[model samples]
Target chain A: MYNPQAENIIIVKDLVKKFGSFYANDHLSFEVKKGEIFGFLGANGAGKTTAIKILCGLSYPTSGKLNVGGFDIYKEREKIKRNIGYMSQKFSLYDDLTVFENIRFYAGIYGLRRKEIEERAASLMQKLDMKEARDKLIRSIPLGWKQKLAFSVAIIHNPKIVFLDEPTGGVDPVTRRQFWDMIFEASSEGITVFVTTHYMDEAEYCDRVSIMVDGRIAALDTPDNLKKHYGAGSMNEVFLKLARVKVE
Target chain B: MKRFLGFVVKEFYHIFRDYRTLLILFGLPAIQLLLFGFVITNEIKDARIAILDQSKDEVTRRISEKVLSSGYFILDKNLTSYKEIEQVFRQGNIRLVLVFGPDFSKNLDKTGNARVQIIGDASDPNTANILVNYLQGILSNYLISLNAEKIPMQIVPEVRMMYNGQMKGVYMFVPGLMAMLLMLISALMTSLSITKEKELGTMELLLVSPLKPIQIIIGKVFPYVFLAFIDACIIIILGNTVFGVPVVGSVGLLLLESFLYICMALSLGILISTITSSQQIAMMLSLVALMLPTILLSGFIFPVENMPWILQVFCHIMPPKYFITIIKSIMLQGNGFRYIALETGIMAGFTLFFIFLSVKKFKIRLA
Candidate 1:
């Protein structure tokens, strides 16, 4: 099902997001190819979230030529929204809803049919080995399970692109590994994975990562190439070296 | 439509799953109605009173009998001297003391005016004021009856409390309760629910989905419309059965007017959610902005005409004021649509205006 043409799933040229006098995402540009695991690496307040929000259509950019899933971010927000999925840093599942009900709700809002929603929910629960927790309330489950369930539900509609903002902030090493495995599985299935994280270790897992510093993309390339260029042994050292410089 | 239904079903889960919120939503109206009906009341029954009849004559005896037979007062003491009236009132059992001047029958026959002084315990001023009015009403009716037979030139200016003859406090409270409770449940609940989604970060997910902003708002508010409607019904039914408040006009019209008011309150809730970012702020805004006005300025407990000019202007702007008027006219006066057309129109106008404002304020993109 993957697109073989290697078309850019997201295109941004000179994007500027300003809040009053502050440039939250100042003069940023990047592109993500189809089915690519593109990492958005930045320290806190480095505008990774602002850029992601603009790209997800949750917000409007002050000035930009931007497109996501072949739809203009400005005039085609609804169309873009239908084609993209987002999971915020905060847990997205309703604590009151059961696992199955949460999945059904998200799928239903995406216009999935009743049979399709049921089938997908069952398959998703089985895939996550959470069939026993299907009828359990989200709050009764563990935080790791809730985060995993949130990501599964976000992409249940099979959107062309999925945005994960710090999806694995507090999960244990084992669950974080499982989460990355899930991301890789999704990326292999031709779903463009655009994720933001402060964890530099997670940066190495991306096929190509863009490091944003002070509202601008300071570096954009594959992990090995970035490590080689910066003369650093790890992505962490590379990020620290890049972020230490003040972008004036 | 299916998406909206799904959202509404989820909302029901949220409401029913939280037993505390559920209790507040359903139990509060019943408790408030009972409290206002039984505890805080204006109607008096079997109040202990003393009669100080100084004349001890036929006319005085007949008037005393009339006063005792009214069923509003039970004779606690009958004093022969004016000095005992103060002692009876100080004992506090007697809410009112009827003091008749000496030679009452001789004075009425010679001058056509008998002096019957009514002294009421003024510690509880509202009850005392109402008791005094009751005594005055009874005295006037007696005088009118006396004039019908003996005096042809006397003008007694007859007074009748139309719709609420006994002046039952529940008659006044049912409509006000409906307004206040409906505003509380509909506006406050919806605002909190929507703001809760924002606070929990679920709103970002929904906004990024295929669901439109209007759909999200209506879906959030739909369950409250149903809940608030049930609350309105509960208040009316309790007011009717427990307190014997009448629904003299059309029940359908009353319910329809209540539904219009609920819509107005629900839209007001959506407007609140759009302006606030958290549930606490939404709750505070709903209570401080909606509750106080519904109670104080809406003619619920206090009459709008009695308020100061500035407050009267505020009362005119209050939607509950119009809703209370509409319900009172329909439920008490047995009034038709024509009698409450203006109030109904104003309520509909408020609903539309709030809907318009919330729609305008609902941002597609996060600000």
Candidate 2:
């Protein structure tokens, strides 16, 4: 069960998204607590992205009761968009632009003032230990550094929630751990983290994990509780146990 | 508004860094103008022809001399009999064959009538037609001189070639090149830049931001408009200084009309962007649907009046047709906004239609 004391920042009930005759996301219900890392796990074509898109206001639902950042999904999409940060599998930094330029570009889009952008960009570079790479073009940096920069840029606006879609894909093991540490640091600052991944080991790092099979969320619980209830050795075994029941 | 300015600055950064795009934006137009203005021309320098004169009389000889000295034809071969005409035509080197039927001077004295046959290879119809027409003109001059005292009732027709008295080739090509260049820069560049962001996923980030979809599209198109305006200025200056193409009308009105045409092209580009999700598709569509049609059907190189009925209908719908007509009216015809009101009005209507259609087609969701 989810923490009873933790406040629900994102609430969804009977959320359904369809593409013509096909159901991309079926009736789904879940709650994400404030300031906790929530893992959205799924196989290919399991509709994890559909759910995330609805929450982020990038897509419309066929029928649903969904709320994000205290705004109704149908009525206040503009409000929800202002309150959340997003990073997709493909990094959205301009390759031809320098690190400082990329940071300024995103911060500028968020309507940050000139003096605030200068001050915040300096501190952000110091925190990421990327002060040296600040003037270097994004294309000249390593992939891991670029991924970390993308995440830092995404949260530069200090949104209440950050939705990361496979942020550690193709990253090495050590870098993935470092990325999770960053996520934890972000969560400690009272920012909610909703991330999707296919890596089972990463599921244990989340405060709560949801396993989506087909279009429905098959399991939603803490990693240890999910393992204990399924009588499995790890979160991986629990995921497989739930995913094996194929939907018609 | 500040956020929109930031977006435009980023677009400029992308454009400045991509040297290939920069070249296409600025260099291609100048090079195309020079190539079209100087290299590709409508005038014939020297055309080759063969003569098969059966009656080698004084009159026929004098006519052949006059035709050769007209500077349009070079006598490639002289044949003795009728069989040589077909052989020389099949040689593929000669463009025209002139044959004179029996005694030309003797027949003129007896019956005041003569027959001269000018045969042209019609494989390349334009050049063949020009050659035949030139031969007929020279023949007429000779006939008028010969019958100067004989026919007092000859009605003299006075002709004058207006607008381009010198018959310079650049006058026809400059307006056309302007239309093609502006379309490529304003329409093609905007669509490509937009679809590039979609492919790179940056567009999604913009969508999720506080920036509205309209703001995003406007920002993406703003830099191209600035660059294309600079391009239009360069085309006008070069056309004036290099080719002596005068902007005889109000220069301000000419530039104003150019900007309006640019707006129409940009709206078309946005429409193209809305319907496509990939840069390659956007580029191919811009080229096939915009560039090729504008160049061929807009009466740029070929006259719309000369095209087939079906194609003339297609040309009427083409936006470039109106744009080219307006430019020529302003530059060559020295007409003001009053004279070009119909053309400018049609272009404005096209811009509104495209903007309305694209805004309708644009959807915020993949669903």
Candidate 3:
């Protein structure tokens, strides 16, 4: 049972998003609790990214009662942005900058002092055991390391929630496993994670998952419960069965 | 504020690390100043002309000597017959042919008048007219000394050129150089910085950051202001030291105006970056849009006043035209801000307008 008194990290009610009269997110509603690892699963163009953009304060929902970290996205966008971290699928780290410099730059942009940036960078790099490659440029590092570093820098300010948009995309299984471990660590520290991914195995890693299809949440429950209800062997089978049944 | 400082420092790192940017920021202004200062000039030096001295008298020889010694014209060949004058003119090397009639001195004494024809190749009419006038002035000066005994019939007007008094090309070009150099650096920086973010995928990251749209723009523009200021200083120093062009107005005022113009140019760069998605397009757009107009329409090389009505109207719209006007007025004419208030105001308006448009475009993109 969801706690009645405990704070909801994200609250969305009747969200509607339109791009030139083409509805991307229509009448969508969801709630994510504090410190919860909420999985948002959808195929490409299911309005998942649009919904995330509105939540992250990058865009305005057409009509909605959207809240992130107890702040209204429309009224307190700047405050919301300050208290949330975002890592995009493209892995937005400066390729020309060294590992330490990238960390310092992001920390600075989040309004950390020079000394504070240095201190936090040292701790973050230490946590990742990246001391040997701190001076190396991001372009010189492997893709997996870059993704991990991007995620770490996103949360360097220690925000209440971190939004990961396909954070494990394109990485191998081992790297994806390591990326999820970091996500778990963040959630353990009372940081809510709102993630969207196509990887079904990664979906099982979340506490609760929502499968969106055609701008609507087709199914929402624990991965195990959904698998049991659908009588499927894995999350992938459940998702495939749901997708096919909707088409029929 | 701390985040803004960090962003600015990172911007400095971007500028300082790139060798191509370093060259454009520093190397270009210096090279352009040197070229404008020395190699390119409007002042004619040792212009070659042939003399057809039919009189061969002492007065004619003395007059011809005076013409050759003025440092304007060098005697290239002495023509024998009148037919040779046409051949020399056809060669295109001789700009002027000084023809003295057989009765040049006698006609001067008896009739109180004399004929000395200066036939110049009129294909390039402006240069030809200038050459003819110069030869006439030299010969008249010689005749004036001999005509004290007789009443002087023709009153030759004394002309004194001002500002670039000698009409040195560098003096004319220095202001142009300042506008051009600032435009090049500003446009290149804005375009490259934006495209670089797109290339590294960090633009999206910044979009997701807590920094406001205005903060990102201000942060990107800050380092470029410093680079443009340094370039302006180099151009001014080279203009004065190498080209002998004086800072006739308040040097402080000139610097202030230069800073304002740099902002205008940088704003244009920012505007260009807002529309362009790649570095190659930005560079090409800046070169074609900013560079060509700054050179041709700003009246740097071609006289905008003499251009067609439409082109002159077009030149009026260019930011460099205002900048060049202010620079020349302040640096060469020693005119104060009061004299160039309108031009300075126009440049300031342009800066504000560009900044506004860029911010609007940036915000729209974010939305």
Best by the TM-score measure: 2
Question: Candidate 3, residues A48-74: lDDT per residue as tens digits?
Answer: 999998898777788979988999988
Residue-by-residue lDDT tens digits, candidate 2, B98-203:
9999898899889989889999899999999988999999999999999999887988798888888888889988888888889999988999898888888888
Top DockQ hit: 2
Superposed by TM-score, candidate 3 places the C-alpha of residue A80 at a distance from the truth, in angstroms, of 0.7
Which residues of candidate 1, in runs, are more than 4 Å off? A1-5, B50-66, B75-94, B97-118, B136-152, B156-160, B241-244, B364-367
lDDT minimum window of 10 residues, candidate 1 chain B: B358-367
Candidate 1 lDDT over residue span B1-367, tens digit each: 9988898899999999999789979999999999998898767888898988889999778877887799888899988788888888888798999888999989999998889899988899988898888888888777777678777687656689889998778888888889899999999999999999999999999989989988998898888888889998999899989999989999998888888899999999999998999899999999999999999999888888888899999999999999888888999889999999998888889889988887777754375
Tens-place lDDT digits, model 1, residues A103-177 = 999999999999999999989988999999999999999999999999998899999999999999888889898
Clashing pairs in 2: none
TM-score of each: 0.90, 0.96, 0.88
After TM-score superposition, what is the CA distance of residue B226 in candidate 1 from its true location, in Å? Answer: 2.7
DockQ-based class of model 1: medium
Top-down lDDT ranking = 2, 1, 3
Instruction: Compute the DockQ of candidate 1.
Output: 0.74
- In model 1, the number of clashes is 0
Model 2 gets an lDDT of 0.90
Off by over 4 Å in 3: A1-7, A113-115, A228-233, A237-248, B49-67, B75-151
